[model samples]
Target: MPRVSGVVGHVVTFGRVLRQAGLEIGPNRIADGLSGLDQVDLTRQDDVYWTLRANFVTRREELEIFDRAFQAWFLRTPVSPFELSPPTPQSAVLRRIHAAGRPDSAAGTDESPAARGWSYEEILRTKDFGAMTSDEFDRVRALIADIAAERPRRRSRRLRRHHRGRELDLRRTIRESLGAGGDPVHRQYRLRARVPRKLVVLCDVSGSMEAYVRPLLLFVHAVRGSGKGVEAFAFGTRLTRLTRALETSDPDRALQDAARSVADWCGGTRIGASLKTYNDDWGRRALTRGAVVVIASDGWEREESGARLLEDQMARLARQAYTVVWVNPLKGHPAYEPLAAGMRAALPHVDRFLPGHNLASLERLGEVLMGIERRHAA
Candidate 1:
């Protein structure tokens, strides 16, 4: 075992060797390896070896090459500090691999920086959240903030002062007419007031959706910062409101607070029961009230009975909400279909069923919200 920084460099070097040895390794795979390394016990040789092998060696044939490269690069005899130059003739295969998948120099020279630069960001924007490396995930946080800032505002029922409203302002018209011997010469009209719509987010923080919860919560925080009325909730076995937790201006701190507040971070999902709790306790008071409800889940319920409860609650939510947008991260997969029991039961009640697997999909959601606002205003 070595320092995390040292191990990451060696892992990247190891990936290069495998590629040169005829294995089809890419930068994404290398990044994935580094991410895997971070999660495992680096001190354990077996843990370290498998972490690299899992990311770089995909095919059965590549395993032999990976073993040879791993032994040659990491397990070989130590050379003198002064002898540290380029790879030797025996190590040329690995050296050439590194050259082929070398990360851009413009990006910072760090383990996390391995997935930076504009080109990387472009790829990351559309990349599925479930497959993203730790570095890429970190970079996308700022992008999420920007997307949240662009979310559309909904019009409110309350009217505000307007210069040319359809309805006449009789009180104002009379006050002005007093100057002209009470003659109705000019008329003033009042228009409906437009306020930012309330955004209620019910995110599933279950084990199945572990990869997506962080990014989705960050999205919730962004929505809150956009000055809209945002109520955030996380559910696994039960529901926990995160509106106050996510109020911190700092994204990282807000997430930490939310994590602390939530009792079930990555437990089993009880979508139906959580929604029922929301509907029973908070729906009329804070959740509905003309708010747009956004539920981020994969639609996997624990039991058949839960699915039935979920369907009823979703139907009730649909009736009260201005819009019911279901953000399922699984929808991003090309072959994916909403055939899960909970998904099937709830889709009928959903107004906008969009993918929530990447920044691009979330941006499309922003567009969808804007469209709803435009239609409402019209």
Candidate 2:
């Protein structure tokens, strides 16, 4: 009975109020609440209440807080003010550690990094993984997981109802016309639904890429966890399927399992032979077809004839893949060039060449994967 736009605005404001009341509400959850509202009778207070509660609440402890806020907002009942707890010892310790990590904290300025024209996150973003200490890498891992949640999407042939779609929904239009004196007064439209595209990540686990492999594989694991259409492989002297090993929820455990699964964990590089194996096995089975293929390697080929073979396999891969992304960590260097034989050979077939050496670079790669349009997004 209420206007759709007005209801959406009200729900969004309600989400903000819940956030102010200490609930971890985000924009995605708010949007999901709006979608849930569409399926239920908004006029029913119980339906509206349950929908909002389901979308916003993550823990049982927050139920009381949510109920109080919902009562005040929807029922217009006066409630007692909620008291805030003092910072705990753990919070104080965390604050101290955060302060210690700040570059300008030594100056005794209380201003945040934003107020000081820089941020600690920005520093971590650009810092090379090889140079980062263990604690710093731990912080970087959380950021990587967040970044990897974004998967590239492609429009599906299947259609869903949309307000502004170009295609007409003939069946819906006909059904609604029966109630409009057979005049089709309320027409409906359908649009192709977008879904995550298949992703195949080949990470180099050889000795040359030892420093960067761990973080890159962590990114791949996060991506795999985000959706169903993901495949992961690790290569040193040979190719090894890592989709099962990286399926573990814990990143450290996943990495450990991946390392154990990989026999040539710190052996010589054989980019050409490994790729040839992938093509003969996976590519032949159409695993790379219409998939966004990411190759994370340092491009150091140990075999004498590896470069020429790498070029051939890369060309074969490029033809089958919708987009080919080559991530070379060494490219992060200021004076870096594609001087390695394998890198130079594969450059011709790469759709997007990126330096995935640091967190910032991985974030950039996520963006590219999300918005890739042309076949050659160089």
Candidate 3:
């Protein structure tokens, strides 16, 4: 029967402890642990243990440290599995645990430590995705998934029952009037239905884009998981449909399956040919008719003739799609320009030219999609 605030504070304190002990714990993981706790019976030690374990433990080496930290903090008994000393002092740990459960006097003050930390996190969020190290990459993926989960929905032509709708439901009004002796007592109205817009992602997995392919696919998987109508395809020498592969709930498993399914992972680029194939085979049937198309590439095509074909395909896609967004990783560079032949060909047809080199840019893309939905709804 502990207060919810007390439990959340303890969880945050435990996260800090883990981070101090060389574990790559972040605020997102701590928040996830708190959410997991809400779903399980906290009275049961086993359930609580597993909930926190699932959220905090990612690698094998951290298990021992996490177990010791859990025992020391929750069970009120310290157990040392290794000869190495604790990273944090015992007195500091006790102070943090105790203070965390108490309300802060200057909670909303700008000079508070929490505010500073938030500012640092904001900077990290805006940093280039390609420039992030392994630890930053993992933390950013969680943020990306969260942003994608709040997917934007589009208004549909069909109407549904709504109390505040502008359109009157004449049939329902008359039917109800009959029951009320030809006098309408209750008014009925209908409003337009809403559905998620279809998002089609075409990512380049060619040799030049190998460094960015993994993160871009992860972003696609997040978009798909958000319940939006998403179709994902990776192109190198050919187009490979990855919607099914990325359907797996686990990001790692989805990436593994996607990798296994793709025949040419890091081969030469053929942007024109791939787009041509997609337009001929899938574009008209699946991609056209109000779908949002996102192409992630560096725009490096192998043959000079391919640039002409790319231009034609881009024009066709632009004509069909509601919006066509081009995400180029190199766009993060201050001196970068769309000088490549393929890029030049496709630029005119693109509706939004965005940088995809970082977590902030991806979040910005999410905002853009929401804006599109808002405009359409109006």
Backbone atom clashes (below 3 Å) for every candidate: 2, 0, 2
Each candidate's TM vs. the true structure? 0.66, 0.68, 0.66
| Residue 375, candidate 1: C-alpha displacement in angstroms | 9.5
- The order by descending TM-score is 2, 3, 1
In the range 1-378, model 3's lDDT, one tens digit per residue, is 455788988998988888888788898998899889989898899898999999999977688888999998888795754433325323322332233323452354445335457776787787876566554455556677777765556788899999998889989999999988988889899999888888888999887876577678888888897785899999989998899889999876777667766777778899999998899888867666688888999999898798999999999988888888899989988999899999999999988888888777888777877667532221
Flag clash pairs in model 1. Answer: 17-94, 159-193
Model 1: how far residue 236 lies from native, Å? 0.4
Judged by lDDT relative to the true structure, which candidate is superior, 1 or 3?
3
Q: Please, what are the lDDT tens digits per residue for candidate 2 over residues 286-331? A: 9999999999998999988999999999999999999999999999
Count of clashing pairs, candidate 3: 2
Best of the candidates, lDDT: 2
Q: Taking the tens digit of each residue's C-alpha lDDT, what string does model 1 give over 17-110?
A: 6766767788898888887887889778899788888888777857766776777787894433222122332232223223322345225646
Q: List where candidate 3 sits over 4 angstroms from the true fold.
A: 1-120, 373-378
Highest-TM-score candidate: 2
Reference-based TM-score, model 1: 0.66
Error of 2 at 27 (Å): 45
